[model samples]
Target: MLAERPWTGYGFESFWGTPLLLNQDQPFDRAWDIRTIVHGHNGYLDIAVLMGIPALCVAVYTFLVAPLRDYMRIPLRKENIHLGDFFMMVVLFAALNAFFESFFFHRADPVWLFFVFGMFGLRQVSLRPMAVRGRS
Candidate 1:
């Protein structure tokens, strides 16, 4: 129960340490309680069914479009289109967009669409000069 001490004292430091039901005589079993089981199942189902598509879209755009934009922007030799650069761009874009969406939009899934568009727009702007210079 809520009033009972946690089996592992480590959780006692936080508000989550407080149990929902306070019955001092009841023991905290290692088995999943009804409430915990239901909540976790529902949460997993929601994420998998509702949020999975957008998350996948974000991941693909971060790995594909972002790097293509960077490649078009940087001036490199004809053979310098390395996979490392693309991978780094993907990681950077993912981290940047994740932080921005988490802190600012409070939605980590759909915000990558904005980043994808913005990156493509910026790439277009940057590509003008390179195209005119016979580079791209």
Candidate 2:
């Protein structure tokens, strides 16, 4: 059982237990990236890129779609928000992300998981029926 332990010191090269993105002296390449799966460290930039996609999706729906309904005189909050539609969109985005990741990267990265969860929250917030008060 002792043989199972990683003694090459390649296990933990960074803070805590995980390596700092790639090893300190490793080089990054597009061709290599296309062939292998290695988690690289982008610091906080990675977080922004991962979180930005769902936020932009929600922002577009809110600022563009929601306001257009107002100009078109569509009812704002009268009818209940359709739960099925919201759930379907979230599933669609998640599936798309998964399929693309699997095809190109050969594995579903944790970033995709974050995008899926973020999409759910975004749709729920954007599709919520807001109460509109009448003009006094």
Candidate 3:
């Protein structure tokens, strides 16, 4: 299905919902049945299959790259270090989980919510100054 339309993709929920799209010519001895699979089980592949490679690229940057860049900039001070560390763990957890689960951008999902929250926290921490000194 993805091979047939790599650029355009099969659209949302088309993976298992569209049986006609599956390769009907496959041998009966095949190990896995494409029809039985609902989601790609991988966030990146799900995005590519649901939308397209372009959308996958955008999602990758938005969800992974941008947040990581912000995380790197957050100051490691005693006051805000915990904030940065906690959010970093959340980002890492989401990133690692994306490989095994397809819950990347689901707005209602807790994983997605925490991931977004982590991004927001990282951004806020990155933007603020580490310390301030008063002048006489």
Top candidate by TM-score: 3
Pull out the clashing pairs in model 2: 21-40, 21-41
**Which residue ranges in model 3 land beyond 4 Å of their true spot?**
21-36, 129-136
Please tell me which predicted candidate would have the highest lDDT against the true structure.
3
- Pairwise TM-score winner, candidates 2 and 3: 3
Candidate scoring better on lDDT of 2 and 3: 3
Give per-residue CA lDDT, model 2, range 1-136, as digits (tens).
1132323222322222234333444456533532233323432222223334444355345434543343234224443334333534554454444434432122475654544454454455455565556789
Query: How does each model score on TM-score?
Result: 0.27, 0.24, 0.77
Collision pairs in model 1: 2-21
Instruction: Write one digit per residue (lDDT tens) for candidate 3, span 7-102.
Output: 888777666577574655666899876666667789888989888888889988988899889877877676577778888899889888989988
**lDDT tens readout by residue for model 1, 7-48:** 222231232223542222444874644433211222212222
Candidate rank order under TM-score: 3, 1, 2
Q: Number of clashes in model 1?
A: 1
Report every candidate's CA lDDT.
0.41, 0.38, 0.80
Q: How many clashes show up per model?
A: 1, 2, 0
Error of 1 at 22 (Å): 20
Where is the poorest 10-residue window by lDDT in model 2? 1-10
